[model samples]
Structures are given as C-alpha cells and as structure tokens.
Target chain A: AQSVTQLDSQVPVFEEAPVELRCNYSSSVSVYLFWYVQYPNQGLQLLLKYLSGSTLVKGINGFEAEFNKSQTSFHLRKPSVHISDTAEYFCAVTPRGTQGGSEKLVFGKGTKLTVNP
Target chain B: NAGVTQTPKFRVLKTGQSMTLLCAQDMNHEYMYWYRQDPGMGLRLIHYSVGEGTTAKGEVPDGYNVSRLKKQNFLLGLESAAPSQTSVYFCASSYTGMGPETQYFGPGTRLLVL
Candidate 1:
C-alpha cells in the first residue's frame, strides 16, 4: 500500500504572492503522483499529474509541481496566486501497476490555500 | 455529455437509516470509484469497480456497500447510516490502461447524519 502526507494543513498568502504546498509520499515501489483542487461545494479536479516525464510538470491555472524521486516528494507551486486560487488542495498517489486497471489515487489530508486579497 | 453525475446532491439522514447514492457516467468508462471527503481529510476511497458487476473494496469500506450492475452506473449504499458516515461523497470514472487516463469526478453529494 502507498500513503501520502501533506506537510501543511493550511497556507495563507496575499494576492500575487508565490506559494508552495508540500507533499510527500511513502511507497515501497514506483508510483504515480497527482495534485487535485476542490472548490467549495465541488468535487475534486485534476490539477496535474506525474506519470513518467520531466521532473517539473506544469498544470492548469498556472500551477506546477516537481516530482523528486529521491525525496519521495511532489510539491505544487505557483509563481503568483490570485483570490480565485483559494481552495482546498490535495496530493494523491497510486502504485504504478495497481490502479484498478486504471490509476486510482490515495489522497492526502488536504491543505487549505487561502489567497487573501 | 455528462462526464460523471451523482444523484441527490444533498441529503439528511438519521442514524440507523438506509440510503443509496447513485453515480452515472456517460463516457463509457471502464473503471468507477466512490470516495468520501471530510474536513481536513481529503478523499478516501470507499469502493471501486473495474467493470460491470465487479466491485472491490478500497481504502475505507466499512459501513458501505457498492454495486456496479451496469457499465455506466455505480451505486454506494449505507445499510445503516451512522454519524461517522456523514460527509461529502464523490464519484469518479476513468478509461482503462495507461493512456493519460485521469479520473473525472462528479459534482458531489453532501450527506448529513444527525
């Protein structure tokens, strides 16, 4: 089994400021990583994913995440944030070959991002 | 087309009550999942189906039952609702294989157990 840990329970930043949400995972074997965003009263939407690619993977809404193999971390970052970026973010992981014939994610406890105006 | 839809956007159930949440996907996806989200807790898998008539337990399966009687629909049922089961439920589906397959989620169903 694989587990994901999000170091931050909440992150608050002023508008136009840069922010980073840290995520770490524990897996005995190779895995896939993903970042998801959930607005108030809405389901989660995929922000980015790390399958097999470059260490730095860009995603929607000007967000990006770097997959660090050695550290077992995939932290999401944004150069600048806006008020609309205030939402709950979750980091998820799945074993390479155990994705229910697809990729099934095991999510973290979530980090609430508050982009203050 | 509707990607994934979960019926009964909100519900209020009492302890020991029974209810079922329906999830339907129009994308012809082969894999479907049920997950619950709570405050400070991200999404936890309740159950999943690889195909019609095949259900598998996920990370958290207690107090829940699932059935995939049709290819496009997956149902999550609570035989005896408990306070612990009050949470937002989400349904997601994805295509099979490694073809950039990412799960598409439903809007969600908010259930409150009193």
Candidate 2:
C-alpha cells in the first residue's frame, strides 16, 4: 500500500510572496506523484504530475514541484502567489505498475493555502 | 465536453435511509472512482470500477455499494445511511487504468445525514 503525508495542514502567505507546500510519500514500489488544487465548494483539479524524467515539473498557475527520490518528497512551490491562489491543495500517489487491472490514488490530508491580500 | 458530472449536488438523508449518487462522464473514460472528503481527512476512496460491470472496493468501502452498468455511468449507493457517512462525495474518471493517466473530477455532491 502507498501513503502520502502533507507536512503542513495550513499555510498563509501575503500576496506576491513565495510559498512552498511540503509532501512526502511512503511506498514499497515505484510511484507516480501529483498535486491537485480545490477551491471552496468545488472539485479538485490537477495542478501538476510527476510520472518520470526531469525532477522539476511545472504546472499551470506558475506552480512547480520538485521530485526528490532520496528524500521521498514531492514539494509544490510557487514563486509568487496571488489572492486567487487561495485554495486547498492535495498531494497524491499511486504505485507505478498496474496490479489486478486496478489503480488507486492515495491522497494526503491536504494543506489549505491562504494568500492574503 | 462535460467531462465528469455527478447528480444531486446536495442531499439530506436520515439515519437508516437509503439513497444513491449518480456519476456520469462524457469523456469516454474506462476507469471511474468514488471518494468521500471529510474535514481534516482529505479524500478517501470508497469504490471504483475499471470497466463496465466490474466494481472493486477501495480504501473505505464498508458502508457503500457501487454499480457500473454502463461505461459512462457509475452509481454509488448507501444501503443504510449513518451520521458518519455525511461528507462531500466526488466522482472521477480516467481514460485508462494503466500508467499515470490524469483523472477528471466532477463538481461533487454534499450529503448530510441527520
């Protein structure tokens, strides 16, 4: 089984300030990592994903994440945040190989990001 | 495309009552999933279907049942509602069950059990 841990439960930042949300995972096998954002009363949307290749993967809204294998971390970072960036963010992981023709993603408890004006 | 959609944006049920939540996707996805979101718990998978007529239990599936009669539709049913079952339910679909395919999600349904 795979599990994800989001180090922070909540993060607050002033507008135009840089921010980073930490995430770590534990799995017996190789895994894929992802970051998702959800606005109030809305469903989650993919912010970025790390399947393979470059350790630094960029996504929409000027957000990027670095996949650190030795550290077992996939931390999301944004150089500058806006008020609109305030939302709950989730980190998820799924095992690399397909087992029993089924795939499931295990998510972290979530980190609520508040970009204050 | 509508992507993924779930019916009954909000619902209320009493303890011991029964109800079903419907999920529909027009993206021609082969894998569908049901999940529940609780405060401070993020989201937990309830059930999932890799293809039509094939439903599988997920991390938290004890109080729920699922059906996938059609490729584009998945239904989650609660035979007997409990106060612990009150939470936001989300449905998601992906093109395939292999690799790192992206999953598209619906708006979600908020269920309240009293």
Best by lDDT: 2
Colliding pairs, model 2: none
TM-score of each: 0.94, 0.97
Please give the lDDT score at residue B79 for candidate 1: 98
DockQ of every predicted complex:
0.58, 0.63
Write model 1 residue lDDT over B1-114, tens digit each, in one string.
978999999999999999999999999989999999888778888898989999999889999999999999999999999999999999999887453568899999999999
Alpha-carbon lDDT, every model: 0.90, 0.93
Q: TM-score per model for chain B alone?
A: 0.96, 0.98
C-alpha lDDT (0 to 100) for residue A57 of candidate 2: 100
Return the top candidate by DockQ: 2
Model 1's C-alpha root-mean-square deviation from the true structure amounts to 1.7
**Alpha-carbon shift of residue A3 in model 2 (angstroms):** 1.4
